[model samples]
Target: MRRWHALLWLLGLLALAGCTRMDLAYRNLDTLIPWTLDDYLDMNREQKHWFEDRLAEHLRWHCQTQLPGYLPWLDRFEQGVAERSLDDRALRTLTDEAEQAAAAVAVQITPSAVELLQQLNDQQVSDLKVAFAKDIAKRHAEKVAPPLEEQIQKRAGNMIKRLEPWLGDLHPQQLAAVQSWARQLGEHDRIALEARARWQRALLEALAHRREPGFDTRVAQLLQRRDSLWPAAYKEERARSEAAARQLTLELLRLSDADQRGQLIERLQHLRERFASLRCLN
Candidate 1:
């Protein structure tokens, strides 16, 4: 269920220009996430009720506690854009803040995940393994089977789509720069697939011993300290990819024109208002 953490990034991205879309999606997330989980492990009535109740509690905690915190980050980002003072250090700081916020949420939810996993029957565990295998195979086919050049092109295209909401259309030079950045980003699909397989393998191993003492501690560490479980090679490759991305983002910001800067500030401002509105409704 750590995959559910990706929702935070999605919410952040969509907040820039699609708050209405994000709001609707966020409201339905409790429902949508259960549907996704049911694909992997079908829960019995009691477990389903427990999960729904826990999810509701987590959502309320996130809205009441976490959403308000984003205001300061947005304010800083807006000021940086307005003053043309954004730099790599500032970007790193922002990234760290976001990670900390997500980690807090992960900590809050880890106990619930452990409780639910510990209750899974053998048949459900088998179903989970099947689901993991199916997901890995699908990802390998889609992400790894592509030719290298095609993969780079697709990666750059996806980055453009994400950036365009705040940056608007990229200039020809910017597009070329993005393509170059994509090429230099070390081969990620293979390493990422390996990392996912490794994590799932570890999870299944942990789940199989669910009745053992300290099982909850082990599972909590697995979920929150996941980086420790990554293959060293994968860790290195992922770090390289992330550093390349950060460099690319900083360069893009440095090259942004007045209109692009204004657009970014406006988008951030709009996101601030949206967060405020959501908190007030809470």
Candidate 2:
């Protein structure tokens, strides 16, 4: 959201900022909407008003329809944690389902995105291209410019930070396992960014043809067919990354103590309750 344009953010809305802030952010969508527009494009006053209104409807649909579905997903995942039965297969299933949820949200908003994009004038389109280039440059600097060892350590640190919220402080073995996992995924960030570059280029090309026939179909394929759109190297890297992550997860769960598992269960339960308590249709 910080880097992408408004439409790009909408297409990738499933990447919530944090595990703990999910409910608060969802409930305050209006306040959060401005982040998507910042430094990305120059939507005029009328266009901004229109997009905001349409975005509201989309969020409402998500709250009322999409979120309920997640409760069950969390249920299954929490059960896996409680039962300590989350092998690689279970992890893969959960990951696949999460991707499907992301696809659903992307597909739902693509029409609105298409409509708004077709309204952009020539100058706005030029600004968008510049913004896209800037986004890639920023990502490259942050992700690819770092030395290999530094990137690996930073990646490990981030993984620990995310897991600590749910798993509590990792002991020596779990910490080592996490670091090993990160080391195994060497150069992953670079691979991911290359795929992102391809995706961004594809979007711009499709946008260039926004006024032509079959433009919507092209955009739809871009958003919904993510794995297909990815370059072959990216696809291979993704598979490797997922396999490594699942193995690391399985190992960590095996190494976790009762207290850590209990903490994880508590976090999942809290998330479920938080989601269920929200009044969506107001």
Candidate 3:
């Protein structure tokens, strides 16, 4: 289930909030899953048809029900952005709502996931394990295997890239804040990788007993409540990371010039309009 979890992040807040191609991405949600699953599961034709039907149903429910809630949430975020008052509390509130939104998607998809997963042969399971190993290795090389200083610099650079789209080019003070935040994160990239690897291990273990009783429950936990798989250090580091992100946001906003704030408001408005205009594509 964690195989599709990245889509939860990629298709939701991160995509909607940052990507220039949000509309295209949102429109492709129905097809995204089958494509993403190719990395983990190579389904037979009948299984693919069955999953497509379920995915279509889930997509309809999401477009009809879940997406409406996002409009109000985006409005709230835009309100704070326009007012130049996105405090830590407001940011945390939005983050919590985003987590809830992701959980809902996971809940909706779990039944389909469980049904399809239970049908996988042992060869498919072995392939999944191999796929996971490759993914973890690639992620580690990209994010965790780097020297600490290099990682910090790349992290800051990436933050600047994401922020510039919404906040415009950051002031020097804002750039400094970003660097500080990145440095403060220290070994967090490693912690995040460890947590993800732990989750995958837990998932593979669960799959070994996929036909046993309580399998659905195990998949639900794996899908919906992955925090239980986190190392204790990861949990603590996650809190620190969130706090650093909030502080960085506050610093960036405080340092932003009037033009940057204006650009931010305009961008948020454009994003809201774009999302609002996305019809429920079948």
Q: Pick the candidate with the highest TM-score.
A: 3
Query: Residues 60-171, candidate 3, lDDT per residue (tens digit)?
Result: 7877778777777767866776787788787778777767877887877788878888988999999999999999999999998989999999998987887777777777
Q: Against the hidden reference, what TM-scores do the models get? A: 0.88, 0.88, 0.89
RMSD (CA, angstroms), candidate 2: 3.6
Provide the overall lDDT of each model, using Cα atoms, as 2-decimal numbers. Answer: 0.72, 0.74, 0.74
The candidates, ranked best first by TM-score, are 3, 1, 2
The candidate scoring highest on lDDT is: 3
Candidate 3 clashing pairs, residues 3+ apart or interchain: none
Q: Could you tell which candidate, 2 or 3, scores higher by TM-score?
A: 3
The clash tally of candidate 2 reads 0
Error of 3 at 151 (Å): 0.7
In TM-score terms, candidate 2 sits at 0.88
Which regions in candidate 3 have their CA more than 4 angstroms from the true location? 1-3, 7-27, 31-36
Candidate 2 lDDT by residue in tens digits, 29-147? 54323224446787899888888788788778877877787788778877888998887777777677766766677788778777877888888888888987998899889878999
Models ranked on lDDT = 3, 2, 1
**Deviation in Å, model 2, residue 191 alpha carbon:** 1.2
